[model samples]
Target: MALLDLDPRAVATARRLAERAAAPVIDLARRHTTVSLERATLRLAGITGADHTHRAGDVPWVNRVVDTVRAHCGLDHGAALPVFHALAEHGLGTLTDLAEATAAGQVQYRVPTGADAARAEGSARAAIARGLRAVDRNRADRDRLVADLGDPPRRPWLYLIVATGDIDEDVVQAANAARAGADVIAVIRSTGQSLLDYVPEGATHHGFAGTYATEENFRIMRAAMDEVSREVGRYIRVTNYASGLCMSEIAVLAGLRRLDMMLNDSMYGILFRDINPVRTFVDQRFSRQIHARAGIIINTGEDNYLTTDDAVDAAHTVTVSQLLNERFAHEAGLGDHLLGLGHAFEIDPALPDSFRLELAHALLARELFPDAPLKWMPPTKHMTGDVFNGYLLNGFFNLAGALTGQSILLVGMMTEAVATPFLSDRDLALRNVRHVLDAAGGLAEDFRPAPGGLIVKRAHQVLGEAVDLLARIADDGLLNAIAEGTFGLMKRPADQGRGADGVIAKAEGYRNPATDLLDTGGDQ
Candidate 1:
């Protein structure tokens, strides 16, 4: 139920403008393939482990295979055909064998110029089918387990983060949080891991702020969470960053591990990580396709905008980004249920009508994307070190969530911005959310904003401003607007950024088995 009567025409206009703005970028994405995409292909082909040639750090086998393919055949034909052809021609028994040969500098991938494309594609499809089957098994297991057990009995599922920089410690904290009433446990990725071009192999024990997002780490966490789920008589969901340079690769891993949700956003890497806009666009498309095929809910990063830009002045930008994210998600075949569109409660508490404004914003998003599982972020931008005030602010944040019917609420800790939250801190934060949820859980069902009141007025004003911003973005191409710092007040030119070199325009016969698999509804 919409507390504020938002204008349908204005919403449609904003959507139209966003669609127009995303058109060219989407076209670019369709026409290009990135290194991450190729590497994801190798991973899907069953290449595990890493090159141990270096004493310090091991390079992933996917990297070695794709790097070899790039040097020999170029990525125009993609990594699938070349690797498949090499495997068939040399009679390599498995992908790992091929990787070993490639690492030994004894293999040269043949460019599929006049080769039997059908045979190569069939072989590639078979390999990818194996991986796709694994993903389907994970999904099936999750559904069956949830059916056998149950889900959290709440509207806004409590989301808590674990960032102990160690996988084992994260598991302990995650279990504790689950027992403490956190419905979802997000294992935050290590800082700067987003910038890495390749995912680290195997379970890691050391990190600066958070654990490395490796396939092994995901596997370990999944096991731990499964045990916790059984212990609690409810399924425990896990999440990690499927953003940054290896967006699609991480998506592949998440699918393999049956991660419940992923931090997948179109503009986040461009705005925050300085990743090339075109590169991020291409990667996000493939990543979302994987998420769609894996039945994974994708949580966008619209909340990050509030951290960098003024929450009041930049309110419309959040809506604008949400509209675009919704469109992109749809284009990638994600249903509304899988689109965990994000927003936040980051408005300054000093404002006189802050609660009303927060209500308006949250309600606006809830009304706009009624079916979407909106991931409402907690206050972080204005989180002072004062524990008492921070606790009060988190209470207000939780109140907004309960009042506006947020789907996924990331519990705000009083220690936010001051330190990595201790387990005790998370317990207190969860208690705050529990208090608000228990007290006002049913408020959204019964409450309605006063007609022409502050909330209604603010909602209309934000919608109007969003329409204006969308129009401006449509007039200037999305890429140009991004280069002009339209989103997070950070300009990332279309040409320059990390991973620019990875973007390759598709050749005539470019093939990605994953896309074809997704299109065929391969074992979802």
Candidate 2:
């Protein structure tokens, strides 16, 4: 029973336009490869750790291997073959030994021909199979744990963030959050860690604003969440960013560590972090493939758009981006069940009918991707350090989530603009959400709008505008529309952003066994 009476033909048109808009970008992603994608392949091929002896920070083994292979024969033919060739036939003792030898200029990497190429491909496939098995084990562990424990109490699960700039502190905070009614805990990555090309190694405690999203950090938090899950008698989900320059690499690590959800948007790196469009598209496809195979739900970053652009004015852009994201995710084998498409309750509270408008937009998204576990975000851009009013605003946000049947509610804190939330702040936020949701648990069942009322009209208008925007984007191409500031009021050219240098056109016989295995749902 949808609250708004949306037109079915209009919805079909919007989806068709969205698919058309994403086709060119998806084609481009298919024909290109980025260094992060190669690094992800190496990571999936059982490569791990870093060689910090060569530099100040961790130079990951994947980087060392990919860089050596790229320097020797370029990655157009893929790094797996040459890398495996060195290890399999050359008798390189281990990946570490190969990394050391390559870094010391003692090894020459080349694409083998004939039987050697076959052997290298076979070995690469085998190594990647081992990595996939690890991912599979983690996925199975999550299922078994959830079956042994229990699921969340409601549809809109409470989501929280823990970012103390220390992995140990984050673990404590995450445990406390889960105990205090948070169903999903996202460990926010350190500020600016996204711009780095290499994934950090080991556990890190000294990040500027958040914890480093290292593999060790992921493992540590997973352990904590598991403990908290047992205590709460419900499975606790852990989330982290699989965005940035090393998007696919982080996705591999997240899968390896059994993360339940990841912040993975196709255009977030391009629009927000200034990563190259080609690089982001190439990397995101591979990352989403891994997420699909690992059974990790992906939460897109459409909510961040409203932070920079007016929520009401840019509401249709949110719809357009969601449609585009859905298409891209589907192309990578992600089902609607795994698409946690994001939107927010960020309307300015000063407007005469702001709450009504927010309802329209939220319900529009709910109706558009009904099967998706929509990640409804709370207000951040409009928080003016008014704790009292902020708390009220969050209540309204929670009400919207309940009324619209949002799947995941990122609980809003009152002291958002004041500082990092204290434990009390988080507790209060949880209380606010629990109250609204409890009081209005079945609100959506009875919440019906008039056939031509304000809410219904507004939703239709937004959908019409979204279809128009998608048609324009389809005509101009998604990249050019992005360059023309069609989203978030930011312009990122195709050839200009960070990581532009890492994008490469695929050559003949390019082979990535990880993609092959993931495409088959890791059965190989």
Candidate 3:
């Protein structure tokens, strides 16, 4: 299925280097925990609702429980060990009860004895197992729906974005897009939501540019998608961003609500959002474990690199990131099929032979990760106010996507830079993608670059550069490379960034049963 003749040795070398670069980071992730991660563990223990009576604000019960544990006993032994101990020793019935009593100043945490520790650990494992069973039920429901209703019968499933700053409004728009031939509907998160340290509660109506990614909103939108799926005869998949400070929290929520995909990448958070590398690494491992158990695909953010750096000049960086993403995701138990590795068509249109260069890059990614469901993004950095030119650029993008056999194609709106896309703009963009895909869908079957042709040569050159870059990164260490402004032109030190204070080193006797359960897809 490959178009270009690539060197297997070089590809192996790149993979080896990527794994070498990721080994140290993976070790760090294994030996550390985060506040959000512990909070997510509490959430999996069946804690819900918020403490509106608190003087500070409407704090989630998970937050209150974790905060109490952190302030009182510290988080070295993991939040679950102490919180569950408090419950068992005090004869509390549920984590919710413990959280309530903690908020009311009724529960006092303490280290437990032999019998008390055994009882607490056993009860905590049972509760976490129950929560994981809920996720198992959700996954079963999704599988049943897809089996009975079926999914889109095409490559490059049309992906559309809906961001109305309101959950109800987003539901209506998402259903309409489904009816209009969108295979996947991604509800864009509200602006700046990623930077918030905690996940919000309930369905929000007032956001700046996009809807909040709360569990309530996820439930509401997924319900609507199911209804529309029955009407359209194709199962509609829902997506949301699972990056930033509350990455693990959102991943757990997505599992409970049965989201189909999540925008998740630790490097994306560290480089673009200024999140601490250590914190991002720890959170992403726990988040991806949740995703792996929930049967959700993860879309990395390598495409965003092109938005900040020149696509032509930084092409090799995209490849290097993809390799590293593959290694990190694999280390976290994500198979190739679950990795929606990202790339984009953002080269300036005025550049000579830009379209050919775009094809070369796209083909290279497709060949590199053949089993991955590549999420091919369209041009945004080069989009101007000229709608016609933008539409034409999208046409070429669609053609490239179809030619390269992209698995998920995010539809590009012609009015991208001019304004937020109206429904009419989405319809027009869908029409453009449909025309190209229908007309030239099988072009790749007959498309063959000449021996040593420009396209083939460019691909080889980029692959060589990527291998070289991966070697340097492996030698320098991924964290040090990031601090040196290696990816996306951002310099984020491992020790200094947002949420660095949230990272906590694990105690010598630290243990988390959730990870043990999820390590084998929750069979335990």
Instruction: Go through the candidates in order and give each one's C-alpha lDDT.
Output: 0.90, 0.91, 0.90
Extract clashing residue pairs from model 2: none
lDDT of 1 by residue, 104-132 (tens): 89898876656566688888999898998
Residues 137-201, model 3: lDDT tens digits:
89899999999999898888999999999999999899999999999999999999989988888
Kindly report which residue stretches of model 1 are placed more than 4 angstroms away from their true locations once superposed.
Answer: 522-524
Pick the winner on lDDT between candidates 1 and 2.
2
Q: Would you estimate the TM-scores of all the predictions?
A: 0.98, 0.98, 0.98
Q: lDDT, candidate 1, residue 391?
A: 96
Relative to the true structure, candidate 3 has a C-alpha RMSD (angstroms) of 1.1
Clashes of each: 0, 0, 0
Residue range 78-133, candidate 2, lDDT tens digits: 99999989887658877888888888888899988899999999988988899998
Runs of candidate 2 with Cα error greater than 4 angstroms are: 522-524
Return the clash pairs for model 1, or none: none
| Top lDDT hit | 2
TM-score of 3: 0.98
